[model samples]
Target chain A: MSEDFYIVVIAVLLPLTAGMLVAQRNPYHALVIRGIVGAVAALVYALFGAADVALTEALVGTMLSITLYAIAVRSSMSLRLGLLAAAPCDPDEPTPEEPPLAQPLLKALRRALSRHYLRLEIVPYASPEALQFALEKKEIHATCIAVTEALTPATAQSAASAPYHLSVRLPRLLEIVQNGVPPTLASVSLYRSRQMTTANLSDSPDARHNIWENQP
Target chain B: MNGILIAMTLALLIPIYEAWQDEDIWQTMLAFASIATKTSIMILVVSVLRDDWMIGLVGVLILSVGNASLMLLAHVLRRMNEL
Candidate 1:
């Protein structure tokens, strides 16, 4: 009876443990815990005579946890501080000369957009709702937003449905806006495409062999 | 703030319900719920302790990465177990 109960508990607990590890606040830490849990779970499965499940869980869980942790850390640390700077000279109170900090950030944003051939527009506003309203009204296509303002349901929902895309460039106000599509989705799609292309390019030779090897 | 809280709550509850029905799905859901809860907690904590903007931005990115990882892990695990 004790052995049967242990089997049931192991079967139930392994996944729950994995889930808890993944949900940890620090993903880097989470991955470490996940690896430890995976190893322990594998041992339990082996003891229960579920060697197949044990082997797969051990290998896949460790690989995935580490990969995910690396990716998360890379993205978080890679955020550019220049992007989060303040918006240029207020349209309402145009100073005769542009601030030194504003010119380069603005130019950098312009160049980034030009690479995608997106038209850039800037609007002066004190409130995010006003900007979102402008976006809904089709006054702008995309803009950089502060993360605090961006997370609002109104802002997030408006962004999801807005004609213009919204993005947050850390440490600056040089939010880039284009004409129709939101930049967020466009950027994500672009990154995914690049990843796929790179994967295909690297795997072509191996793929050919597998195809040939599998052919009867 | 209120709105975000509500959204996070609803997002978490879906997986908790799914977990109740299927042991396999429950495991997966448990993982998801754990991550979502942690993210929400982090966002709330950061909002209180530091700049709301910085933490919020980081929170969203973390949430996305966490969800993506969970989904990928579940799929891979499922396939491997099949063999």
Candidate 2:
């Protein structure tokens, strides 16, 4: 009877830790709590004289799953942003200076992504055309392009002041970057790829270009 | 025997609470290390109480191996921070 009492008490930890695991919002923290849950479960199993079960729980359940989940979470939770590669310059070579907002924009992006527990990875393309193509192909989630010349009178004022325009393919990501970055540093807009637009718009190259030019 | 086990269980609660409440990943890692070792030791105690050699063997194996996994997890976490 007394032995059963202790066993029951130890067994209660399983649900307690499981509850804690369910309550965790952070993936990494949840993984650690999972390890705790595994340890408690092993104790309960061994307390019941299930030696094999306890060993398996310790070996495979705790160690293997935690490591796997950590890697999976690390790899999946990231935002990939495409950038225009800087033109070649040498020590003696005089090239146009990088945009003044470059460093602060990246800092703001990192800060915003970190809030969502996401990492920002910048992929540089050789030309603006290539960057646009990558965004259309969904090779990247978002692209940050410097406005070399104002394309239309509508955006000229904002483009002149902002200097950078961020075109994001995903609507949700557009919202995140919009809220995260200051408007003075960059203007944010959503880019709908051919697949997402109507079939008639997708049929004509000119219509597609018009859609790209029309983004707010 | 029951009293000793109960005491250890109470002690184990300390790190579990720490793991739950702490937000810093490293502090939670420390709590995990503490819980892993304490639970293995508790397993060893239970094995001794029941005079079960099989369970004792499992306990010893977990005591040695659990820390190895912890080290692996810590290394992975450290590299994550570096990147």
For all the predictions, what are the DockQ values? 0.03, 0.72
Q: Residue-wise lDDT of candidate 1 within A50-135, one digit each (tens)? A: 54564455456644655565455433322221112244333455332322334444565556654443323444443444443434
User: Taking the candidates one at a time, how many backbone clashes does each contain?
Assistant: 15, 0
How do the residues A44-163 of candidate 2 rate in per-residue lDDT, one tens digit apiece?
A: 989988889999999999999999989999888888887765643234533323333389999999899888888887665555555666678777899887777323355455567787
lDDT of 1 at A52: 57
Models 1 onward score TM values of: 0.27, 0.84
Which candidate number has the best TM-score? 2
Model 1 per-residue lDDT at A189 = 12
| Model 1 error, position A181 (Å) | 30
How displaced is residue B23 in candidate 2, in Å?
A: 1.1
User: Model 2: runs farther than 4 Å from truth?
Assistant: A89-101, A149-158, A194-216
